[model samples]
Target chain A: MELLLTNLAHGFGVALSLQNISFALLGALIGTAIGVLPGIGPVATISLLLPITFGLPATTAIIMLAGIFYGAQYGGSTTAILLNLPGEVSSVVTTLEGYKMARNGRAGAALATAAIGSFFAGSVATVLVAASGPLLTQVALSFGPADYFSLMLLGLIIASVLAQGSVIKAIGMVVFGVALGLVGTDVQTGQQRFTFGIPELSDGIGFVPVAMGMFGIAEIILNLERPEARSVLTTKVGSLFLTREEFKRATPAVLRGTLVGSFLGILPGGGASLAAFGSYMMERKISKGRHLFGTGAIEGVAGPEAANNAAAQTSFIPLLTLGIPSNAVMALMVGALIIQGIQPGPRMVEAQPDLFWGLIASMWVGNLMLLVINLPLIGMWVALLKVPYKYLYPSILVFCSIGVYSLNNNVFDVYMTVLFAVFGYMCSKLKLEAAPLLIGFVLGPMMEEHLRRAMLLSRGDWGVFIQRPISATLLGIGAVALLAMALPNLRKGKEKAMAE
Target chain B: MRINHRDVVAGLFLVLLATIGLFLNMDHNLGTARRMGPGYMPWMVFLLQAGLGALVIFVSFGKRGERVEVVKPEGIDIVRIVSVLMFATAAGTLYLTQYGGVRADKVVTFTIMAGAIAAGAIALWIRSPETDGTMAAWTQGEFVAFVAAMVAGVLAWYFIRGAGGYFSQGYNAVGIGMLVGFLVLAIPPGWRYLGLICACMCIFGLFLEKLGFYLALIGTILLACLAERDHIRKPLGVLGLTAFLLVLCWFVFIRELDIRVNLWPT
Candidate 1:
């Protein structure tokens, strides 16, 4: 505990630097702005901004990116409350009671509760991350190649299982992404696999283009296909303070949500959306006013909002300690870390303590900054929604094109982006989830490397995976997950949960 | 005879891609599973994809599955979309060859010209009054107009081939072909607007180095604005917004960040 506190104190020293603080503030502002814009989530925004962060120090870059993430979580609830639009999937539950609260003229109270709950969750989760990061790192250090392979396999399977579509289709997307990842020159044999004689692809497909194409440009085309109505409540926002009764009702819910979120966020493939949804379900079951869940209950907003923010903060635990990305957003963060020449893994804690702990400390600062920024800036964000999407979409397109082009300064990347955009559009049309594809793409090469190493180390014994206890257990879990997905009743339960 | 299932079509596409990938890597050594060669993983992946594709197809045939409703477009709409795609492809090919160090020769130019003519012919055929059940006389007039537009496109291509260092002959031919075809066929206003915007984006990518940042951005934004329904009614406002955005981009990307992009053509 003393050591952890000392580490956190050192981290606060790094995070409180003027430059780091500025980066955090910038990330929070940008995150909030993008979060307020319906359909443009933090994943796309982070990918869009990834190229710009290439020049910053790794610690500062990650601090900014992390800020954007949780800041967007906070900003997402604003739209949910005011416009009944969940800007991010994690905020979808917020709309259930948040929009109702708005209708009942408790919009200010709902917003405040979310902000305070998120702040509380963020602080607690930051401490949890700091305290548990080293423990997880130590656990990760004991893992072998076979164990790592099985764990990644389990993560990929869980990701596909949790995808919002047919499990089979999601699996196919994952396989397709893995195939795409195998494009460049083979590492061991110096031979190009699928370059098709294109020298540009010898380095493999650029992640920026693929990500921006799938999430950014494809979203534009999808949005264009459906005309959206922006129906925002224009009434005066009431007091930002919650009533004493409301505060009393919300505090316990927030604490419960933080616990639920913190626990789930550490598990592979459990992220903000799952945590938020799970917290809401838990709240509905436990709250005395459960009947008022869908009828302007402040606890409804408080629980999910806190859970999502906490989960968003704690989701970094796996990525930071194990080098395993639990979700698509973490997958992108891994990409960012790789670009900074920092190989994220168990060694990350000891090798780069400042980067790891500084990022953790910045989350608290970012949450505090969000609370300070969002309350006063709420009206500004609402006015931003009034901007016509017609104007917004074109600029977004131009920026995306520019951003992709600027990566490697090659127009071929831009063309690749267009191709992915078309493919992404087709996937959306088919109701295929793109998230698993991204996770697969990011983890595929690493998984292959680990698997090959394990095979080589075991002298080509296929039983090596089963012989190891951890690997065996992880594979067993993966097998059960696949079996559950194949079973219709469990699949229905999953879909029901997803729908909620 | 009638294959209406979208899943089946998607599966078939995936199956075809896997087959092609497998066929292309047939010669590569697939070493033992222990010491996998370059092709081993790809072969495994392709086979898995093919199996998944088969499963997708099988599921599509299930009794209680959701059927995807495919919206078939009108012939004219198909013609317009195909023409745009063809033009974009031609431009992309030319850009790839010229800038990306691909071999650009007579065959490449010929292929581009052939593609342009095919796109133009499709546009003319789809726009023919006979296809729409109009009078035969009008159909004849449309055919004449199509021929005249083709001739004009060819003449423009011939005249502009040696005019400037900025424009390639292949790009000139494709551009003239697309413009003439669009004018002769008189594409629906909405589609035309979208086509122009897409074309501008392509142009921006193709000429960002040659045309520079400000000019390309202004032109792209201007064309993008045209896609809006109210752009025709508020042209000045759109133009003003374009100017304002160009300035903002210049200050942010160029001046503030020193992004290394030239403001004007070198």
Candidate 2:
């Protein structure tokens, strides 16, 4: 406990520096800005803003990125309440009760509940992450190459199973993504793999171009295809504060949400994506306001909002400890870290304590900053939403063009972006989820490195994976998971759970 | 016939990619399983991928295909755009052969060149047979705008930053720019707005070095605005947007990030 407090105190010292605070503010602001945009989600927003982080230090960059992530979630829930436009899957649940509350003339109350509940859950989860990060890192330190490979394989399998569409298609995308990642020169032998002798590709495909092209520009293409359909609420936002009775109804739900979110978010495959959905389901079944569901219950908004924020905070444990990205957004984070030349793993905590703790400390600071900035700016954000898609999309295009061009101070990367945009559009039409592909792209090399190292150490013995207890256990769990997902009844349940 | 069209096509695409990967990776040394070569991991991955692709195809037969919907762009002119794209592809091929530093394999390289040329030829005759051949005033206007802008961009880039020798980036920029424009037709006609915006990015990339920041910025914003009919009629708004972007890029790119792209043609 003492160590946790002191470590957190040091983290605060690093995060509270003027430069870091300013970046956090900027990330949150940008996060909210794009989050309020009608159709772009958190992944798209982060990918769009990633270019700006290229110039900052690794810690500051990650601090800002984290701020942007949760800020977008905050922004997404705002739209869920006012416009019934949940920017991502997690916030789709928010729209259910959140939109109803807005129609009940409680827009201000709903917004406040989301913000406060998020702040509370975020505060709790930050402590949980701070307390648990080192312990998990210590546990991860003993993992062998075989164990690491199995764990990553398990992660890939889980990511594919959780994907919304066909499991086989998702697995195919994962394989395809790994193949794409293997392009450029090989690290071990210095032999080129799939560059086709293109000099630019010899260094491997640029991460930013692929990410920006796949998520950002593709989102623009998808958005432009549809006629603009945002219906902004013109009703006055009456009060920012909740009534005592409403607060009383929300307190217990917030507690329950924080508990549900923190626990699930630690699961390797379970990230923030399902936390809001899970909490909403729980609240509907058991909360005091269960009867009020579908009619704008405060519990519906409060529980899910808290759960979502807590889950977002705790999901970093996998990335920080096991070096496994739990979702596409986390995959982008790994890409950013790699670009900065810092390999993410158990070693990160010891080697870069400043980065490690500062990020943890900044999570709380960012949540607080969101609350401070959002309540007063609620009117401004809503008004900003009134900006038409025509103006909005062109500006994003120019940004993407310039941002990509600035990467190498040339146009080659921009060309890559164009290619990926077309490919991304095609993928959506084919109903393939890009998330698994992205996760695979980021983790593929690491998995291969571990696999090769383990094989070399074990003298080509494939049984080494099963021989190691941790590796065997993880692979066993993965096999069970794959089998369970194949079950007819379970597959039906999975489709329903992931349908949103 | 009852199989899911999306799954079959997606599966076939994956298979094609995996086969290509297998073929390309076949030459690399595949060492013993204990000490793997650079090709070993990729080779295994491709095999797994191809198997998965086959499985995807096989599974599709069990499910009914959903009718895929394609939305038409409300009133966008596509003929002038295709003509310009064809002209640029032919011209870009000439420039690439003359200057590109392509150390890529001859067979693969020439195949791409030939493909681009053939695609350009087909695009040259892309007008729908049902439509009358008489050109609209707007088509003529769009044709002039696109050709003039591209010409100015190429000339400006050539005179200014085109000093770099054999491996000039003009080749790569134009090559990738053609990729989206030519292949976009594979999707339904109504979905060509995607191609247009992609072309805008290509224009920006292709010209940023040659035309410099301000001119490149102006060309891209103007071209991008053409895609949305709502913004095209309002020239003042377009101009305002151009100006806004100019200053925004100046402040953000030049002042803030300190990226060294020039402001004007040297």
Candidate 3:
């Protein structure tokens, strides 16, 4: 405990540095701006900014990226309250009570509750991370190659099942992403697998192009296909501070949300949206004002907002400690770390204590910065909504083109981006989700490496995975998850067959 | 017969890709599964993709499957697609001839291939009758004539450069041809501005290093501004906004950060 406290203090020393603070503030500002905009999310925003962070120190870069994430979470609720439009998926629940509160002339109160609840959750989750990150690392350090392989398999399966689509299609996309990840020169044999004679293909498709193309460019295309819808804001934004009674009602809800969020956030495939939904359900079940659940209830606004923020922070635990990303945003972070020449895993804590701890400490600072930045800036954010998307889209396109070009100063990457943009559009049209593909792509190579290493160690004995207790348990969990995903589909298939 | 068209198309595309990948992997050594080679994983992936494709196709044949209606493009869409393709080909040719160190003969070969493909595409477009009422016969005739002239000019430039031993000068001829082509092609009413903006972006990328940042950006903004339906009426406003954005980009990306890019053509 003393060592942990010492490390955290040292982290604060690094995070509070002028340079780190500036990056954090910048991230928060950018994150809030994007979060306020409908259809733009943190995943795309982080991927877009990934190239820019290549020059910064890893610790500063991650601190800023993390800031952007949680800052966007806070910003998402603002839009939810003001526009009745959820900017990010996690804020969908907030829209229920938040928009109602805004309609009831309690926009300021709702915004304040969201901001305060997020700050509280962010602070508590940061502590949870600091406490559990080291412990998780210790457990992860004991895992062998087979254990890692099984764990990754489990993560991928869980991600596929939890994705918002047909389980079969999601699994297919994951496999497809894994294939895409296998494009470069094979590490073991030094023979290119699918380069098709392009020299760039020998190095594999870049993460930035694929990500920017799919999430950024494709989203722009999708948005442009339809005419813009005017956003309606409530006329009166009364009283930024909550009433004494409202505060009393919100405090317990926020605490419950933070606990629920922190716990769920550590589980694989459990992201901000799930946390927000879970907390809302829990809040509704226990709240004395359950009858007013959907109608301007402070508990509804506080719980989900706190839960999502806490989940957003604690989701970092898996990525930081085990090097296994639980969701797409964390997967992007893993990409950022790899670009910085730091392989994220158990050794990260012991090898780069400063980065690990500094990032955590920066989260608390960033949350504080959000509270300071968002409340006064609420008017400015609302004003920004008045800017027509037509004018904004061209600028976004130019930025994306420039950002992608700056990666390697090669036009081939730009062409690849165009290809992926088309592919991304096709995915959307076909109702396929991109998140599972992204996580699969990130984990594919690592999974292959571990699988190969385990095979070598066990002399190609397939039974080796079952012989090890931890590996066996992980594989068993994966099997159960696979069965769970398959059972419902199988039942549906049988029902259809019988009907026919 | 009543299968979901979207799933069928997607499945076929995946199957084709996997088959090609499988064929490509056949030449590489496939070591045992324990000690895998370069081809091992790709082979497995191709097989998996093929299986998934088959499964998707199978599911599409189910009774409750949703059939997708593929919307056919109108005359303006064809024009936009062809013009964009032309711009990309010319730009790619110029970049390769100038910086990629391609031989003059290879440039000529590529230009011929691109011209042939464009000709085929134009033929296909002509075969497809216009569905929109706005596409008058005269307009179609004018569009076809403009496209043919543009293609001829580009091909003539390639021949002149190839035969006249002035490979570098071919770029100027093609650029002129494209500019004239764009000016001559009367845009149909109610066309989406995104198409024109996309074309402008292609041109901007092509000329980014050659025309310099300021000139390329100014030209792109000018062309992109024309994409708006009201650009003719509100010319000055669009111009001013373009100038402002140019300066902003210059200050942020170049001046403040000192990015190592050429501000002016060398």
Candidate 4:
């Protein structure tokens, strides 16, 4: 314990240095600015800024990148709350309740809850990282291909079953989303599946166009179609403060979210992506304010916000301990580290204690900086909603188009966005939820990869899913959920699914 | 007879999509369960899709068509096409091996090719006299905007023909661009607001490299702003917002981020 404290103190010393703090602050500022754009998410900002980090010292570079990652994520949730635009998968859950809160004039409360929840989760996750990095790495490395496949399968099932409509239609949407995701070059075979001979689609459809189209552009069309809905985004701004009751409700959810996120985030592949969705499902099931879920519940925002934040912090575990990049952002960190002549792994702790512990401490520092930066900025973000819809939509369209076009500098993506927007608008009229489709889209490709690899490993044994302990447990839970969903009389589980 | 219009339409749409999926997917190998090929998962998913869609249609039969659009009796031909296509393709994809003297992949491919052509012929012969208003969904202003978008896209395509990627596909991107414009007619609210923004994006995409960021921004913003009637009420606010947005974007995206875009026309 004393050694842990000493290491953490040394980390804080490195992170708090004058040079490091400025860079960290610069990263946060840039991340927030870009991330607040309609379609620019953290990954895009990080990749764009990655070249700039080449010149910095190894530890300082990692610190700034971490700062940018957190800042961009916070900015993402801000727009997801205020503008109903989720730039990525993690923030999609935030939109379900956060946008509703904004609609209910509680945008302030939702923003505060997210900022505070994220901070709390970050702090706890930082401590957890410092204390048991190696131990958790062992648990994470235990997961095999089957385990990952089963985990993602359970994720898709829960995402669809917990969606806010008929389970059948949601399943159809999920299935279709998977099909859309398959519309690129096959990773294993190098043969294209559904690209229809378009070379621009070899990398698959960019997620930004699909997400922004389905959420932001479609939203503008919907709001305009309603004659009385003009300027609905400019509803009365409520107090930025969470009420005592709200705080009391959010506290437990935050704690639970931190725990959920920390554990899930340690796993590789798409584990961190599941953090917010898992927490959202849990909140929908048993949070004290579960009844208020569809009406902008504070618990919904608090839990998922905390969970994703915690996941973001703990995802560094694989990179720091196992020399594995958990996601694209961490892979970039690995690249930065490789460029700096410092190899990441078990040796990293002993050989480069400054880099390891410093990165850990800076996660907490970055969270603190995000709170300081964003709390003052929430009022301004909500102020954006005050602009009349007529002027605002046009500006948003420009930013969104620019962001989408910038992905590959191809206009084909702009066309994809237009197509999805029309489809999304149709979905709204048809009573089909877009969330499950999105979840399926994000997870489908990963699940296919893992499932194929797992099948190859087990030589086509259908029993392999239940044969492994981890996958067995995951599939067990999924089976129970599916069975409950299937039995109409089972109001016990539908109590929450029906509420959504 | 009254029918549950929403469920029936949604169900038919899903089945149509699955049939298309099966056709496109049949060209790939469907290896056994243990050693799956690229087509295996898609074939299974498309089958599940057809089944789910059929279930939705079957379930809708239990409900009174409450305030729903009644299906014209003559349009039963379209329904027949949907159901037969669904069953035939799903069965062909699954039981491809049972067909003698053909490889599994070839069997599935031949079945889909044969089935799609047959279905097309049937649909043409049994032309349902329903609304058929997908083309009529376009208004004059929207049509003008779409044509302008197409002009911009085609001009850009011709000028940039030396480039690779979608250009190598011979105006496939332009066709894709037009597809989105037409898709506005496929859905609800009749393409007024959605089509305008979509057309604005198309124009922006076509001109951003050549005309530069500022001009494209102004052009697209102007097109999008026309979606609102009240924007003409306060043209100055619109103008000021456009000007302010240009400066803000220049500072934010260009100067601060060093995004690779020319601010002025080259």
Candidate 5:
């Protein structure tokens, strides 16, 4: 405890530095801007900015970039709340009540709750990061490939069951995502599997292109097809800042989301996004005002936004401790560190304690920065709705394209983004939830890796997944989730089969 | 009396692609000790995808006479979309031409892309206010403004890097130059240069200089502009200005306190 406090104090001192604060503020501002622009998500934004971090100290660079990551989530909510256009998977839930809130003239409250909830969650989660980093490392060490696979399976099943819509459709999307994830080079072998002789196919499909295309571009296309019923915000923009009653309602949800996000964020695949979705689902389940869920439920906006930010913040744990990137943003952070000649793993904390601790502390500062940036901007973001559409959609496309291209400096990604956007538009029209597909896409590669790794280690023993206790527990959870999903269908099927 | 063509097309495409994938991967191996072969996973995925495709196809065909409500696409919008595509393709071709001896900087490249896309959006906006309007404006104006501001901000950032000599002096020169450049390029020449002032204020704010005055000035201009338009009778303009100021202040005191800021350039 003494060591932790000392480290935190030292971190705070670093984060409080004038230079670091500036970077954090810049990151938050840029992040929010990117978030507001549909299709340009944090992953692409972070990747684009990765090169700039080469000049700063590791801690400052990370703090700034991290600000952008979570800030984008906050920004994304603006679009979702006002326009019903979610920039990324985590923001999908935000679109539910967020847009409705705008329609109901509660855009201010929705934006406020999200901003405050994210701040609360971020602050609380920072404490958790300080307190639980070591403990979570211990838990993470216990997870092997089988355990991880089972955990991902559980995540998939839970997400499917908890999603709003037909369970069958969710499952189908999840299955499709998983299958699509298999399109890259075979991990077990050195040979290309699904590449139709396209040189790019040899490396397999990258998630960035597919994700950007489906969620970002496809959304633009679909929006273009139909006249938007309203602007991003509705009603004459009022003070949309949270009222006292809203604060009271949102505070608990923020706390809950923070707790849920911190723990889940430690896991490697789709942690932040999944936590966001899960938090919203849980919030809906527990809320007394369930009917208000799909229509301007403040908790709906708060929980997911808070959870995503918290998860994005806490996800640094695995990357910092184990040198494993659970998501694309963390992966970019790893690249940034490598460019700065810093190695990522356990020794980083000891060798570069200042850098690590500074980063963690700066997260607190960054959260404050985001709140400061976003709170007053609530009305401004709401006003974005009044901007003539002629100038709006094109700018979104440009940002999305630029952001996507900057990810790898590859035009192929831009093409892929367009393709995915078309796919996403189609999915939205078909009522196919893209979240499951996104989760599946992230988990697919890891699943193959784990499967291959387990197979290799066991020398062909398929029972490894069952034999490991942690793995078995995760599988158990997956089984439970699957059973939960199947039970209703089975009940319905019994009568149908009887009728047949 | 109809089946969803979109679903049918998607299903068929999925099935076709997966089949081709499986056939191509029929013999690959990953060098695993167990020799599960690289093709193993791909085959599994292909089969699963094929199965799902079949399932979707079955549903599409099984539910005969079901009226599918799809968002309709007008012929003109499709033409506009194609034009955007043509423009993007042309831009790419021009970019390639630049590689083939045509000179282009990052600024030029970005400007061209932004301009082309904006022009396409404007054309669409004039034709379709309901469907393509909001998105068009967002893409062309606001997003472009944000990008240009960011680019200018980045240039100013370079100026802030040095303290006095070539590094420091050059920093200020470039920073000022960037702001001025944006003021000229981004601001509309029309509204008594109201857009130009906003661009300048944004640039000043980015440089951590005395930005409050410009913020106020921009606010006043915006307010005047809004006031002139009777139909756009909302205090949102004022509210937005205030928000901008508030955000600027927050960035100053909280984020960049070390910088000496006068709040008025002149």
Candidate 6:
């Protein structure tokens, strides 16, 4: 406890510096603004800024980037509430109740609940990082090729379950993503795998190009096509704040989301996006008034918002301790640290206590800053609905392209982004949730890399996935997810009668 | 309108690509009898893609041609979007390649490229009266603001931290202080542009090593021009010309050449 307090104090000292604070504010403001724009997400934003962050000190850079990651979650809810457009995939749950609340003139309540819930979650997750640092570090250090592979397999299965859709489609997309990941040069053998003889392909398809294309650019194109369909709520803005009753209802959801998300976010292959969706679904399942769902339940806004923020904060635990990125954004953070000549692992805490502690402490400060900026700006953000959609949509596309191109100084990425933008739009049109596809994309490469590594280590023994304790545990969880998915079908008869 | 045709087409493309890929993988002599070869992964990827492609097609287009309902853009709207994108790409390329010192056999490569793109876009907008194209009218202010931005970008490059002649190591104490001052005072419309400038600065050192001193300067401008232009055909044209020049130079040095031809337009 003394060590925790001392570390927290030192962290405050570093984070409270005027410069660091200013950077945090800047990151939050920028992150929130971009996040409010549907389809331009944190991954594209971070990839764009990765090269620029190389010039800053490691801790300051991470503080700013991490701030953007969580701040976007806060901002994503704003769009969901007002426009019925979930800016981030995880924020889709927010759309069910958030937009309904807006239509019912409870927009302010929804916004407030989301913001406060996020803050609460972020605060708790920060503590988790501080407390669980050592144990997570042990998990990080002991991971071998086999362990890593099994963990990723578990992650893939969990991600598929997290994607609320046909399990087969999720599996298909995961396999597809793994195939795409194999396009680059083979690691062990110095031979190009799927270049199609294009000089650029020899290095394989770059992640930024594919990600930006599929998610960022695709989102813009889809938005433009549906400009007429978007119904913006211009009804009464309500109290412009969360009422006492609203607070009482939201507190429990926020706490539950925080706990669930923080724990899940710490696990490898888990991210804030997945945690957010998981929390939102859990909230719906537990809510007394299930019929009120999808029409703007306060719990919907509160739970997912909390989960997303907490997951964003707790995601750093694995990275700070184990050097494993829970998602692409976290991967970008690892890239930033590597550029700063800092290898993230168990010894990082011992070697650079100030950096670790300072980052953790700064997350709270950033959350506070976000709330300060967001609460009052809620009105302004809603008023933005008045703007003409034609202008709004184009700028979104431009920003997405700019963000993608900023990654590698390569125009090829922009072209790829355009391709993905169309694909994403098509997916949306088909009622195929892009979230599952993304989950697959994010986990596919990690799964393959680990799988190959494991195979090499175990000399082709497939049982390696179930041999280790941690791996076995993770696999067990995966099996349970699969079983749970099937349980609904088995109980279908009883469930129908109960419903009637 | 019904089934998601876009998905069907995308899935079909994937299947076709996978088939071709599978054939190529079989042709590669990547491994021997003792060890797994590099072709192994490619073949695995091919099969996986083919399988997934088939599944996506079945899910999306099966069940008696049942279609997935989707929102779609009109033909004209798509054209407008494509045009705007083309303009942005062209502008970015021109700005990066022309002034950023990317070497090429041409002068004012960025300006020419941007003009071509802007001209085409303006023409397209004018042709489509029904389309709002957003802007009420192309005003002097917009033009002046654009010119100023371009000039400012070039100046930023000139005074960048690592451009040398101004600051040691391109960004020593004085350079960083100046950069901060510039940022505070100028505040470029987009921070990404500023980031790009920093990139231009950092890559300056590498350019020095790759290209001879004189050529590096030229190459920087060429690259900057390409960065500003949308599609890179023009810059590639310049690069092609340069390659020709290099080949000629080789001929003169080793094979002896009496023929004289300056393929570069500039």
The best candidate in terms of lDDT: 2
Per-residue lDDT of candidate 4, residues A372-425 (tens digit): 988886666555434566766787788777777666567777778877886777
What lDDT, from 0 to 1, does candidate 6 have? Answer: 0.60
Which tens-of-lDDT digit does each residue in A1-500 have in candidate 5?
99889989999998889999888888888778766765556665665445445457778888888888877777777787777877766787788887788788887778778887888888988887777766655576667766766766666676665554445455567777776777766654456655544566666676566655565545544544444433443354457557787777777788788888887887655467778877887889896556678768778888888898888878888777766566656756765676567867656777887888888898898888888878776666555535654334433443344344444544445545544653565466445677667667656766677777777787888788889998888788767656764565553543342221
lDDT of 4 at A42: 73
- Rank by lDDT, descending? 2, 1, 3, 4, 5, 6
Candidates, ranked, TM-score: 2, 1, 3, 4, 6, 5
Screening candidate 2 with a backbone cut-off below 3 angstroms (N, C-alpha, C), the clashing residue pairs are B157-B210
Candidate 2 TM-score to native: 0.88
Better of 3 and 5 by DockQ: 3
Q: lDDT per residue, candidate 5, B83-108, as tens digits?
A: 56566556655555655475544444
Report fnat in order of the candidates. Answer: 0.37, 0.78, 0.28, 0.52, 0.22, 0.13
Among the numbered candidates, top DockQ falls to 2
Q: In candidate 1, what are the lDDT values of residues B77-161, reduced to their tens digit? A: 4554465456546554654556456564443344444445443434333222222123111243454454554455455555566
Q: Write the per-residue lDDT of candidate 6 for residues B59-157, one digit (tens) a residue.
A: 665443223233132233455446455655655565566556755523234334544444334322221222233322333333334344444434554
**What value of lDDT does candidate 3 attain over all alpha carbons?**
0.75
Interface RMSD of the candidates, in order: 3.8, 2.9, 4.0, 4.0, 11.3, 13.6
- What C-alpha lDDT, on a 0 to 100 scale, does residue B14 get in candidate 4? 69
* RMSD (Å) of each candidate, 1 decimal: 6.6, 6.1, 6.8, 8.8, 13.0, 15.0
* Candidates 4 and 5 compared by lDDT, better number: 4
Where in model 6 is the C-alpha error above 4 Å? A38-57, A103-105, A196-203, A264-300, A318-356, A383-385, A400-410, A419-449, A479-500, B1-17, B27-36, B54-266
Worst 10 residues of 2 chain B by lDDT: B128-137
lDDT of 2 by residue, A45-144 (tens): 8888888889999999999999999888888998888888888888888888988888888989999999999999999999999999999999999999
Clashing pairs in 3: none
Q: How accurate is candidate 5 locally (lDDT)?
A: 0.61
Question: What is candidate 3's CA lDDT for residue A218?
Answer: 79
Residue A387: error of model 6 in Å? 3.8
Cα deviation of A431, candidate 3, in Å: 1.2
* DockQ of each candidate relative to the true complex: 0.27, 0.44, 0.23, 0.33, 0.11, 0.07
**Candidate 6, residue B61: how far the Cα is off, in Å:** 8.9
What ranking of all candidate models by DockQ puts the best one first? Answer: 2, 4, 1, 3, 5, 6
